[model samples]
Target: MATTFQKCKTDEKNKAYPCASTRCKHPWTVRYREPGGRSGRQREKSFPTKTEAVDHGVKMENDKREGTYIDPKRGAVPLKVYAEKWIGRQHMATNTEGTYERAFRLHIYPALGSRLLSAIRTDDIEQLGRDMTTAGLSANSADAYLTPLRSVCKAAVVNGDIGRNPFIGAKLPKLPNKAVDETQLPTGQQIQDMADEFRPEWALSIWLMAGLGLRTGEMLGLRIGDFQEDHVRVSRQITRGKAGQGPVIGPLKHRRVGDWRKIPLPTNLRDAVRAHVAAYGTGPDGALFKTLTGTLVAASDYATHFKKVTKLLGFEWSPHDLRHWFASTALSNGLPLLDVSRWLGHKSINETADTYGHLTPDSTGRAVKVMDVAITQHRAGLVLDTAA
Candidate 1:
């Protein structure tokens, strides 16, 4: 028997194989025997130039043997599908999964969902990042959009769906390394004024953030049961999700075994928390903070309300500024770096010192004084130094 290759027709009646060429693309028809007793007809893409079409066909055949080929008929899976699968494979905690899912839905999918996985190039990713930057997304946020995409590309490579990960050498925009000055610690007067402007609940929220260094999510995630004899346990956080997905409760961010701090709860704050719990506790699962409906309070809810309060009070601080306030206050009050680190739940004193060391003017002055005293003592012990 002779193997025959026949040119396919452009029209449906002639019914030949379709061409894979983007321009002048058509299909070619072939009848071939299977390894079994069955015979079948396969249609391949037809190219205007036979050689070009044959070349692509040959390469595709070779890829089939090398196990590096994906059927065009299957099409390139969209990034969204791969992302969902990848997230499922991740051993992330509940909160982490929630956060990643939110980032994917809100950021990555909107940017790159329509493109085929194989069609994604470094240029595409770079441009996507640029577009995000141009659209007023922060550098950090733009970089965040890349995280899910990178994961998807890697998965494609592992599955042999694509030859190389395009994001491998992609250049992302540089994020600002400087701490945000506008959200930095508030002045004493500013804190007092801001506190005075809020209702008891909102004021306490601000106080915990600035006064206790609790993350906003952590503060909202707290329950009455988490309070101990003297300290509040930081074991979980509240995260918001997109669409109909409700807020998820998960473990503390960057949590470690010894990550929890046991700062003494102020008497007033403790009393307020107890009172609020007594008055509004929705039972065991009842969140410490909630809307009028008794549901988990969204970060947006508190942030928007806090902003209004701050505006009314003429304070220029953000909710996170409370953390800075706590750190700065501790350092300025002569708290040792190690103690401050423990109080702030920092992994190390070095981290604490790096962030608030400049606030320790008194410590610096004391170091100078100790050096001066040592020099004075050395001079006093010198015999006839002036008679020399």
Candidate 2:
């Protein structure tokens, strides 16, 4: 028979079956057979009115018929268990996995780890954001932690543990824009001054970074052979691997084997590299830049040294600031934004525009010039017509 609901009065003598006493504490029951089962199952729930019970039973019946019913018991697994399984099934880079794991341990686990998967509601997820803020996480940091939780919830929806993602409509906190205001990062004169003032040993690397706009790993990954007649090849990088593991040499970020970018070599940067190579020599594997002891340059070491140098000069900058300077210089020099993006190995031109759009030539003035020419031509045509 089809699923059905009945109003029942319950008492201590007959709790499972219905009793007719009006004073009975519990009142409603629904009878439904599990999918692919011959026997029936009955569940008792408290309902204020028979109409509410009937409506709920009808919805359950429809869900079962549509093969979308999720037995509440099936989702009773604790969130901690589900999250572990979900994270295990993810195929991601080791560094990304480490990041996700860190976020889970730092923010997600402590708040909702003990709750059942089905018991969590939208309000609970909202409270998680609030709790992260209360714990003194910045807006960006809190959002980073919440990213893994959102992914986990999405997986749960696919697994039928939840009908919908609770965090779907929730908004993450906004981060304030902290970008520096400059059309082109330090002009030609300023760059020359910085190069002159920087330590002799480090000047070449600074010039290369400002010239090529390479990421830190990419800059450190360069080998003598990568520099050719008129360009530099970018095919490899060194970056931190999984948590606790140190730096690892690997393929360039977001690329596969043999996928490399080639950027034109500027004359000044080429001269600096040639001079630096003559003075210091390459690493064992021909790394262009190496420590005094001839080992691969570590990012941590570079950061420490750069910080001290910039502090001494009273300049507020990081290694990455040089790359931004390169992009800004390229854009402001009338180079095509798309070309600049390719040279910098950006994933797309849109990324290039978003990062350095402010440095692009003024489109409004160009449009006005075009319109002026068109209007001038039209007026000349009218003058000729009158003379004819």
Candidate 3:
């Protein structure tokens, strides 16, 4: 038997909502009241057969359960509305708020601003990746931009607003592997030369960064109280951004409770830090580093000064390069990876090994010496011949 679906209208004038199929042969109509209100009844018209009307009703009921159905007349919602809702629900850490804000302003809104939330597809996400790559954005940067959108879309799916996350199937660009650039590290002699060329105040900070491997944020966050006669306690670090920004005084990255130990201050560095403090004691709230206007210095300002000092010394490197130098130099000087990891506040020794693996030498002479001693002892009958 062949089956046909028909469009129809329902009876009931007071409840005059329109339906596609009707029971009457000539012009059966269905009427239903507006949903959730006492507004005027909406009417649907013209079903030639009773079977057609029943099938339409069954389909509507199924669509409501599956959440695939949308009223044809109601329009789509804008993306910005959903974005605001997502932001409000986000429980971001203090250090991460600025990053989220930047991602929203620079990436998400600009790329997907005009698109309807319902119409966004995986192809749209893939196109975003391609366009970002074409525009010279690094693969990592492009990924960062897309990550927030993925989160937003995931939220939509969880809430039943959408069926699936579009970003799940989108192809992303390949990210470059990050390795330390050895050229950036200054040699021991170069460090001395820079210290000699720059003012004591400027040189001191550079020396700490290069010699002690302190992050710029940690350096700027140093307080008078953090420094003792023997060692410095790295309890807090300065995060870059505007005032009232959270995470101003959080523990060091990957730092465990017992891991926060004191780093002994070298004689020269200790003296220089003392002198700088004597000259510029606690600003308003006892901050160690401050601006000319006597306010806490921003990280960018510290970086500017660092660059100026490095330039004056004729060294073309970033402040972070000094930390790399510290790690590399320590490894080259035969410091064990575990010791270096602890000194640099790394989470694990594996991190040190991975970062400084290139610095390891063959140690063939030491191995040969051990082998010779073992052979002589074995021949002299002083030791057991394990090789035999």
TM-score winner, 2 or 3: 2
Residue-level lDDT of model 1, residues 278-377, one tens digit each, is: 6656433856777776678777778888889888866666777888778777777777767767766666767766667767655667889999898888
What does candidate 1 score on TM?
0.67
Going through the candidates in the order shown, the clash numbers are 13, 0, 24
Please, what are the lDDT tens digits per residue for candidate 3 over residues 1-388? Answer: 1123332332334243355334434444333332323563453433565566556555544555665644422225567677767778886644455656677677777888777777788898888889888998989889987777778888877776765678876778987655566766788788777667655544566688777778887776677887778778876566653345532544566653224656657777778778888876665456677666776666777777667877887778777788888888777788777777777777777777777767766588999999989888768544454544
Q: In angstroms, how far off is 127's CA in candidate 1?
A: 1.7
For candidate 2, write residues 207-262 as lDDT tens digits: 78888998888888888888887899888876666666665566676676568999
Q: Give the candidate number with the greatest TM-score.
A: 2
Deviation in Å, model 1, residue 354 alpha carbon = 6.2
Q: After superposition, how far is residue 334 of candidate 2 from its true place, in Å?
A: 1.2
Each candidate: what lDDT?
0.68, 0.76, 0.67
User: Order of all candidates by lDDT, from best down to worst?
Assistant: 2, 1, 3
After superposition on all CA atoms, how large is the RMSD of candidate 3? 8.6
Over all chains combined, what TM-score does candidate 3 have?
0.65
